[model samples]
Target chain A: MTVVGYRRPAPGINPDNNSSAYASTRARAPRHPAIRIEHTLSEITGPHFETGGASAIDLTRGARGEALGERIIVTGRVLDDDGRAIAGALIETWQANAAGRYAHESDQHDAPLDPNFAGAGRIISDSDGAYRLVTIKPGAYPWRNHPNAWRPQHIHFSVFGTGFAARLITQMYFPGDPLLAIDPIFQSVADPDARARLVAALQMDVTVAEYALGYRFDIVLRGRDATPPQE
Target chain B: MKTKLTSSQTVGPFFAPLLRGDLSQMVSAETRGERVVIEGRVLDGNGDPVPDAMIEIWQANAEGRYDHPEDMQEKRLDPAFHGFGRVGTNARGEFTIHTIVPGAVPAQSAQSQAIWQAPHLNLIVFARGLLTRLVTRIYFPGEIANDSDPVLCAVPAGRRATLIAKDIERLAADKAASRRLCFDIVLQGANETVFFDV
Candidate 1:
């Protein structure tokens, strides 16, 4: 189950969880089977992606106009394990509107819904592996995971790397969110430094003057760099 | 170069809407292949259903050739077969994908130059509690080649069944219209599906 270049995910990340299961994750499953076979040229090679995508990257406005809430810009560069930019990577994001309520039937949280914000966006990384999006800062909403528990403001990200092996789905959190401390999902990663990678940093350069605040998040895919041994 | 790889966080509970919007189906009118329906559920260690999980599949077309430029094989390419599909689990924790039965591809290993791989589908799994996505492959049942598949053979013999999809009779009267296979994903415990690290 040893993945050649995959960094062992820090403890607490659940690639699978359910409503009836224990509130906190149980023991980690045994090593994965995919790691047992050496990757063929097919596994290492990826599908080609183009710059133009169908979905819009601006989530600040929905079908109508500008959504309500503090405006912010999220930008990032996708890189390989060797630090080289991955051009044309497809990035998809979904989150709650400014009120921390998702525009979905399943979300029953009491927060007010934003009619102007659907909270979904997609962008293709440019030649430099850079992609950007503008949206309202999502609010913290309560969840049934724990009593009186509120999920920290965050956006869901799906990064399609150069190859299927490089694909990653994760979340980006705002810095200084107090919910990070008590959230079992965030605290699942045992390493402080690793958890920090999940938080995007405020980037003044990417900020629009007199407009939206900007945050920078860089994502790195697996590459020649060997994965660190499991703790 | 000294910078470490970023850690993975959970995809969480809210991605079903967006995923369903864009990549739900792998087949279209022009797609070429033997049409089939692959269905299954995502279960936790306790055997409880995982309702919010999302699954994606990538595979070769009916001709065993990929839709990518990297696949230099001269096999015919199905312009309609995008070779990818995504679906979210329902209240019953089940998800279904309609795709073709992919043809076998030549082995890449120098030692196995003469051997062709078993027909299979590459998969990625993501759910609320999973910090990162899981990778696995689905092989068709009764394929004698499964015994020799480089990837399938890598798995322990007793546990290999976890990776093979079970052939089922389609309930519909027009059986030839579509084939069916059931493959459940056990996230943990004794019957956990064989996830790959690659």
Candidate 2:
């Protein structure tokens, strides 16, 4: 290993090469190179294929805080490039309940108040990469930056370990909240195709229990390219 | 378990500008202070823009001066390498550089054998939907001196097998002496380049 501190590769491929660029010289030009193919569209990545990461999730019984108001259910699926469900994926969500009140002080806001809702849930993707969570429908809240601004109730999402790109973090917005138009962050994505990825569907919602309103969402996690890419 | 995307009232304000314009501050790690351009693109398997994605470039200046205290050297830097610049890919997922190629740099350690290693650039990527930053490297074409570099040796010969600059015979009309190299880094997926763990 110490020898690597000062060695240069020559014209041909050297099995000893050990750096970011190895054998850069090829008298011939390449239009493109094809590598492996690995892709996904869900919160699914296997351990064999993973990337950068950090801390951990707070799965302990409500350590995030106590429960708050109106009960609701959130459910979703994770898919692959072929649109197949990614099994055993994990889906986690956290939000402010119907009153837009969080159990934590970081969200400091004044709105319809709910003393009992802490807003949080976790569900692992089933065989078809489908996940479900039981919580409450969160209410909209105000933002100081833009006019006519009230953020629709939404939950934050993080997907890790399905290997295509292994790590993903995004937000999920509910239907009919009416405030998607003005939020600068939500509007940052100028492409409607890209923006549509952030919007959760209203039909994915299912009425499973009398006390809970159910919702379904599907996520796509990228997979590794099976072959080397060309130029 | 619950996580908020980025608290609009908290961390949101700091990164929101990235979505609006030239996005100079949104990306870039740091620099030793020079003037130059960096070009590249963020594409999916089908050659598409990972649009609105944040592409950060960090590199050493002409004499190999890094903004990092560790790589901080008195070597005179070219005013052209300017240490940093940020460009968000357009609809096609391509980015270009008006900057100069950086000079050779010393490895990032106090190791006894450390000498000047070959020239290269480090890149970090962030987009609206992905969770973590993607770390990658960009190496110059035909820098034979890299063979024995410590950093290069750290990787396997097969994976190190990738990451080379694509061979080209033509120069841009405007570049009288500008030597150009094309390196298309692969992000793992159905039809993409090889994405490194870094």
Candidate 3:
């Protein structure tokens, strides 16, 4: 593998492109070109916080309430381009409930909402840039972005790096979801390997004896491709 | 080896619960800086309100210092300022941000020697059907520094106005939100907001 310094890399399609057919972009958004700005200490430094306070990762357990669904443990490390762990980075996530229904009022989906599941959590990375979350496997939900369309089972992630420019927000899909093959949001990525980075791998060690299954998802904030080049 | 960065996905319409959290405020009453209210609507190509969108803002403190370790400059860090704010659009596709008027930051490169950025807010927009989050900046109207802002100068002359928020009115004597500004974001039509790559 080749090594590069901490300088932010050049533009890659996955980091820049937004499909035109993506209904929202086609709406009243900018068609103008974006100006590329170099990163500075201002864009490189992020907020610092204590390991724990109100920040918690378990979404399944709320105040005197428990969400109804199959439990799962999602754990991972936040690394830089060099695969070095970045401790204290903030990771926030929001997902739909087990019935494929969101808790927001805007969601007109026919599925019922689970009162106990708020489906949101935030946590600071450990010394190894490691984080663990307990949540239900969100179900696939239908949408009209396209005819007869349904989003695949996935969770939304928002990660804050040292600076404002380092912010990376994306979705995480399950390892074996048939819906992934046809999902437009997944297909918009264009690069197969880049798309694959969104899927978590099963980890037996993290699984609770009878409580939950374990999945590992390690995120590299910026770096040379960790995957072998496509032939 | 060629590493492809992971692509972005929509935050969707369900981020409301998280939006209601306390971190949504960029500056609180205890914050040491001039307070301002940024209000605006999110319109679609058809001039319709995008009621489900979410907006987030990040900026430096009033003293041109960031609340980060890398920004170890001499300016004092305002203990009350966090420099971050988030809000979801209301039914009218409008959102308001209560924040301090950020101070200017220095250019990121030596090539632009002695160049300092005008006070501005970096914004990120999220909504349903948006495959990716839209990034942009809101510059204060009538700021002289804007004329030389390296990033602002990069925009096509006629389109520069799209990035500057217009001053609506100065708040009355007894208010914390000392200034008010309006900046409507057109998602795709005539006056589309200028989105930045970074």
Candidate 4:
């Protein structure tokens, strides 16, 4: 029996690993070209995440009280490159608190860490590949990448599609953010259209009345071709 | 396509809290096969340790069968084995996983030729500086079938050693006491590990 392989992303759709603007990539990115290989069972198969337990969808409320920041509702659909829904995919998100401080030991920013905000959440996309996250809007933070370098407010996303090849890790930025133009990490992708896909758009339909604002960010994973390999 | 795929991003330096579950153990006491300990560190081009890296591994069970629907090979599935593990590198850039030695499974290609793959674990590395996850594999040392393994054979001969794990005792110049294999991953530089585009 022969297995069909997932289609590779088009050129410029993915960011270059050796992007120079991101200072860390200088010493970390691979210099040699990646060895191309055909997909085997190992590549086609992935670990299935059980969706039975309660998911950590709401990050605005912790043990103490409501977090300090503007509450926002982020909703999105996980789809394949062919526009098909990728049901039951795991979506993990993490961000800094409203004061641009992470609840991590390594984060030494001169900002207060909200006792009510842990800044992490996880959920499984529904059967229709839809997922919603209720959280506080993250704030911009400063990094030592360059002098006076400030990172734009964004949420880190880790998604697992149907197969191992479909896994993705990306950051979602807000639309109309002036920092988008100057943020090297956001500008790493050479393609304008592909880079725009990383920004989430405001969606009034998902907004709660007198509650949280809403943003929509749809994710696309690599899809398999229609034709299967011959036996 | 209706929408372009989202571009990859670095996992950043703050994912340790999000990944709190114990995913380093892929087997239980009832799990079958030879138990082995895989340990390693994540390094960068300058040979400095990457303290904020996450490693995920997927492989077959003791019977050489995956816990996935795509694997239809006739083999018994271990109820106690999930055949998957995820671990974050410590502050020192070191990580360790306790798993069994997966069995070699039958390889299927477009030509339909019957071939057996050498036992290996598929690994993915996600770190603060890596825009995209790096894909690699871990092949046991002294495996006779490594020469013919389709995936291993595809890698250049000189760079294949990066994929093989070295015995911990051999590195210590002592008699082997336990089944511990060390495989360090160098993202770049002179001894960079081999990464696959698949």
| Cα-based TM-score, every candidate | 0.88, 0.42, 0.89, 0.96
lDDT of 3 by residue, A116-180 (tens): 88888887888888999999989899987778889999998888765566567789999989999
Candidate 1 CAPRI classification by DockQ:
acceptable
Task: Point to the candidate with the largest DockQ.
Answer: 4
Q: How well is candidate 2 docked (DockQ)?
A: 0.03
Residue B51 displacement (Å), model 4? 1.0
Descending-lDDT candidate ranking: 4, 1, 3, 2
lDDT of 2 by residue, B17-45 (tens): 33334534322434332333444556654
lDDT of 2: 0.46
Better of 2 and 3 by TM-score: 3
The RMSD of every model to the true structure, in order and in angstroms, is: 4.7, 17.1, 5.1, 2.3
DockQ measured for candidate 4: 0.64
**How large an RMSD does model 2 have?**
17.1
In candidate 1, what are the lDDT values of residues B1-198, reduced to their tens digit? 545566666777778655645565678888887887888999887788888888888888999887765566777888787687788888999999988889987665656345678999888888776766777889999998998998888788888899999988766776666788899999888888988766
Q: Least accurate stretch of 10 residues (summed lDDT) in model 1 chain B?
A: B106-115
Ranking by DockQ: 4, 1, 3, 2
lDDT string for model 4 (B16-121, tens) is 8656878898778899999899999999988889899999999999888888887888889888897889999987899999999999976756566768889999
Q: Name the best candidate (by TM-score).
A: 4
The CAPRI quality class of candidate 4 comes to medium
Candidate closer to the true structure by TM-score (higher is better), 1 or 4? 4
Candidate 4, residues A1-231, lDDT tens digits: the string is 577788888888788898889998898899998998888888888888886533338998789889999999999899988888878888888999999999999999999999999988878888888998999999999999899999999999999886787888999999988988999899888889989899999988989999989999998998885544432
